[model samples]
Target: MMTEQDTEILIVGGGVGGVSAALAALERGRRVVLTEETDWLGGQLTTQLVPSDEHIRVETTGRNASYARFRDLLRSHYRAFYPLTDEAAADPHLNPGAGWVSPVCVEPRVILSVIDGLLRPFVSAGQLTILLETRPVAVATSWDRIDAVTFETADGAEIVVSASVVLDATELGDLLELGGVEHVTGRESREQTGEPSAADTADLLDMQGVTWCFAIDHRDGEDHTIDRPARYEHFRDWRPSQLHGERILGFERAPEHAGDPARAYLLTPNPDDDPFGIDVDHRNMGGAPELWTYRRILARRQFQPGFFASDVTIVNWPMNDYIGGPLFGTPDAAEHRAAAKELSESLLYWLQTEAPRPDGGAGWPGLRLRPDIAGTADGFAKVPYYRESRRILAERTIVEQDFSVEILGDNAAVSYPDSVGVGHYFWIDRHPSTGGHPGGGGRPQPFEIPLGALIPRRVDNLLAAAKNIGTTQITNGSYRLQPVEWSVGEAAGAIASFAVAGATTPRAVRNDERLLAAFQEDLVAHGAQLRWDSALRW
Candidate 1:
């Protein structure tokens, strides 16, 4: 069957950025059509099985107000519905998982429910339409403007959507390739980008690794081991040069301590330490030398005594990072994705059979997979956790020097006259790549998202909404975080709505001072912070 639809704004990915863009557009009274390849939205936070990775100042400052509200809603949902202890429910800063990664590290399913609730009003009012299990297959373009996009549904139905503005929010930037929007993949050479962290030569296939995350809970004296995967041996003994010949399935791994050699990590579940003893704002408390609590999604201590048997944690460690091939722009994309899943499964098997214990023993056979938490038949997340995307070449490509603290000094970043929003990260964190580029971890200063970065150099009616915005491989490391992505999507959505109302192009909005100021004021009115406060600097 074939169908056609028209809208004011078309968002082609339902990750954090896509949802934010949809809300922003719908609030501005523009009809929106949002599509997602997976059944669930909230890509990294839900389907990808990763919690919100945020900066220390995210709670009070250095973040978009809308993003902050999303966090508050997640916490409020737990307090309102879940069986939290009075102490846990009353704490203003509730760390559900008490995980080191983010303060709001709850299960992926909770995020899906909260996001659906947030979009429910617009959806019922008919101002927003959401299509799940749909992906873009082709793009209609003429004279540097996207005319329409054809999407293939899960059941083989075709739906062609035409919109005045198209936002590319796919995790891998699928539209950039299908629509022929000029984009750059992998690391740019030092000579090209002038980045101190850039490689001497460019390798298009050197993109960061992707992980297939899963959740597990431990039960003592019970065997819940899964059947061994078919390719278990391949991953058990397999290792790339990035790990210095150490098996990736083992506890000792490289990049454990930044600027140091490989170190051993332990697997201790449900330690006796009180989860409430730690302060929410302290980052160091979660950095304990144990694997189980690193990304814990459910801390049993947060509930009443005997309410839960065990804590649930997500397995997204380096052991499962698949760097054998890139997911986009490759013939072996399916093979690579399958291999990544196998790697994660093999890691689980190893943990259940051979992982080291504190009492000088082998295996914890009690580790069980929680498919319900992931909302999938299998325990693995519905989609791989992607770290890099096909970034568009835009009017202004943010570079490493623009925010690297080592180069710009502490509390300093390049000033942008057309700043749309701000984002901050502790470091430029990059995972290993297929092209043998060991991941980088350089400290970074708080940065701004330039309006020019959202506008494609030549595409008239398209915008980069997610990790696909204009940034070099080096700078993408920090800009790709959750809040930053939300900020970018919000800015893109606001720009599209403004362009439609003013009957002007995004380029004209940037080129004309009067239009740019008015557009920025509109963004401010929607609770977006255009710049960071002086007190936020380190």
Candidate 2:
């Protein structure tokens, strides 16, 4: 028997920075509610499916105009409902899964149908409410604000809400450990963030390692193998001494730059050999080494050749990366998220039985498992893609020399006069950890986002939109992707609608420089770029 409500902005993780902080606090009229532990709302692009990794001049410059209108409403929902192929319909940047790891690689139910058509006009003018599957589980607070939270729904009940401005936007910032705030979980040392690639000590269980992504297609003579994983021979004879031991369900890994070495990829899936440029660039990681068109989302030569015949792909490579632990606050966090969904069902039963093939055989029983492109019946991805969170304790934390291209070699990143947004990556990708810590990628230099890293050194109104800001676990691996969590959730919903229309406080609009230049001029009159233009670098 628990109910209660009230809102001015509550947010709590609807993901992709709580739907860009409830579309920047319902286009600044406020009164939002948000919530969502996934019934789908584009968190990591629809229930953690992961695609929009951006930057390399995202179409033409550093992003955020509401994340370029969510990549222009996902290429206007595949040009207003797919069928393409007139040269992929007059190519104006249509990469609808011509995927070499994202240039708008479509489908996670078309990013939950462009985030339900951009929040169905603030949930039909009731000024947004959302809820979906819920999950917050108690907060209340007082001495430092955050007066109520509670949640817990997907059937169980209990509601509670109450808000003045409390973003957190979950995905592991679970209301900064249920509102006691002052965060910072897993990995912090090189003497606590002097970060020469950290970890000379502090290891709150290291972190980064959460995969569980899925979605496949294939179909040659059809077999669809599945149902083998009950710890399929313990992840098929697992091997990870930080990968030198290899056998990460085969297909071999370790070599997207950080001190390179371990190799062996090539999955092919559609290759008729050479000349297949789909235009990649996740700093060359997806510059195609061919793991089935590396995250290909649809591309049947961009539709219309007999209306498609299997080209969908998405396995989030590094052979189903589940560095064996950490999915939550640990106590073996539900057996490490059920052994990372049994190592993504034993890497789809070792790619449907022993991989290898080239005219030489092994498996692929015509691959399968689409579950309507992972809206999930059991095909995975309804969550589990995180690359680290629970960060705050902020008042500006972001280290790794504030944007290391080997310690700002050419100089950029670290501007912040309370900056507010802009993000880039090409390094500091970090992924192998569960305390084993082999993660690597390291290049970095394009960053920005600092509104004192989304406040919170003492909570006040609690912001930190996603990947729980105020970085460092080596800058939360480049501010944890998807267009920097949609510009750190449209700058925490335009700083909770300019601190609830100026009763004022997000650390008094970031220590008042005349309320931080009128909230960065209302976040650049609602387009929110904040900085990063000086002839854009990589």
Candidate 3:
């Protein structure tokens, strides 16, 4: 017999957005049936094992109380489990990784535990039923509403979930296609979006590259070489056409920059390291420093003597990005996926055998991959860190005019009457693009998420709870980051709860000004952020 479930909210995809959505719905007393393709929750945080790539203002401004609490919990976890030095422990703000990229960087498991801890209570009370290692097989839609979602478990059991509201929080917005919801993928025309950074014409299949992040440690004078990848020779000899003439493994310049391209950083060389001062700090990581410390998960100095061997860093750099093709929604999707994974392996090989060392030599033969952290014996993440998703053909697409700091110049972000949440990130970045588009992207202003964006134009009961929200290709870059995705999911969950409680459809609640205001109030009560302050306003 097939497993059948009924809930008020059906949240698909257990990544950051899915987990956040579940939490938000549970907080609102909504019964939820959450499904995850992977056994673990916290997609980017856990399955992908990538450290937080957050904005400098993470400690203050633009973040919600719930996310802030999550950060505090991560710090507390380190203090409780690990042996931290007195200075590191007593410091009110303890960044576990001490990574330069973000204020709160910790192991993926730390976040997984925190998320599971939060979800356990809901599960115990039977308010939330989480189905792990399950993938959605079919979605049934009646007229304009999502009637039910069906999934096939790993053990070959079929499960059907009929819910009042269906939130698509999947990594690649798998629900968008399964439910026959209209969506936009790839680059949008500059004229369509009026985005300065947009391509001149629409390129439907062009999307951001996905990275298979993996963790590694440095053991001086020890050899920890991985078996050379099957496509090692090809990747080793190949050069990136997008980065001028630089080898894929070597220094490269942004397409915008033509000079001698800046060099890639290394674990041993310490070229970007501040020789005399502290290497890790909360400074703007715009230079080589960003690459070097971009994903360092564990800083040995923070712990007591002999507690750690060497600093374990994660490999999620431009060098490992697979721009050969988009992962899903393409004919050769599986091959492209394999190529991306191989690229990551090639990157690890280069770091071990070809990357230049500080001693005027090449390669760090001692560099080793940490399989335990990545949850794979091969050292690659359990899942690729997808940067973009098939976004819903939203009622209101976010244009550059809405959030580009270059355009807004200090003006407050354009306000939305149905604002459900708030977030801030760079506009466009490292797009794994086709047709040799630009590499680095434009800086962006903070932005407000309107309820209209979450509601698909024709899909009555469905909601976009992740990067699948209403955003143009240009806007998707920033909207796809960690914090912003979390906010999007939170907003979706809140909308679902409010709609069920009011006995209204998603469109109806969004259209009613009074109902919309009440929903926003509920978001505030549940620790979701609704707005930024006046300082951000010009």
lDDT of 3 at 14: 95
Candidate 1 C-alpha lDDT tens digits along 386-408: 99999999999999999898887
Compared with the true structure, what per-residue lDDT tens digits does model 2 show for residues 1-538? 6788998888888888888878887887888888887688778776877777776677776777777777877887888788987776777878877776667788888778778888898788898889898898889898889888999898898999988888888888988887778887889888777877787898777787889888887888889898787778878788977776777888766574667665777886765422136656665564227788777778787767767787888888887889877878878789888888788888888888888887689988888888788888977788788888788888988888877878777887678888878888777788888888778747777878888888888878889888888888877887898888888888888888888898888888788788988898988888788888765556
Poorest 10 consecutive residues by lDDT, candidate 1: 279-288
Please, what are the lDDT tens digits per residue for candidate 3 over residues 215-292?
Answer: 888777999988889999888777666656667776544434556446554454222343123333433344454454
Better of 1 and 3 by lDDT: 1
Those runs of model 3 whose alpha carbons end farther than 4 Å from true positions after fitting are 252-266, 269-283, 290-292
Q: Give the Cα error of residue 423 in candidate 1, in Å.
A: 0.8
Is candidate 2 or 3 superior in TM-score?
Answer: 3
Per-residue error for 262 in candidate 1, Å, reads 4.6
Top candidate, metric TM-score: 1
For model 2, name the residue pairs that clash: 42-46
Give the TM-score of each candidate. Answer: 0.97, 0.34, 0.95
**How many clashes show up in model 2?**
1
Question: Model 1 has how many clashing residue pairs?
Answer: 0
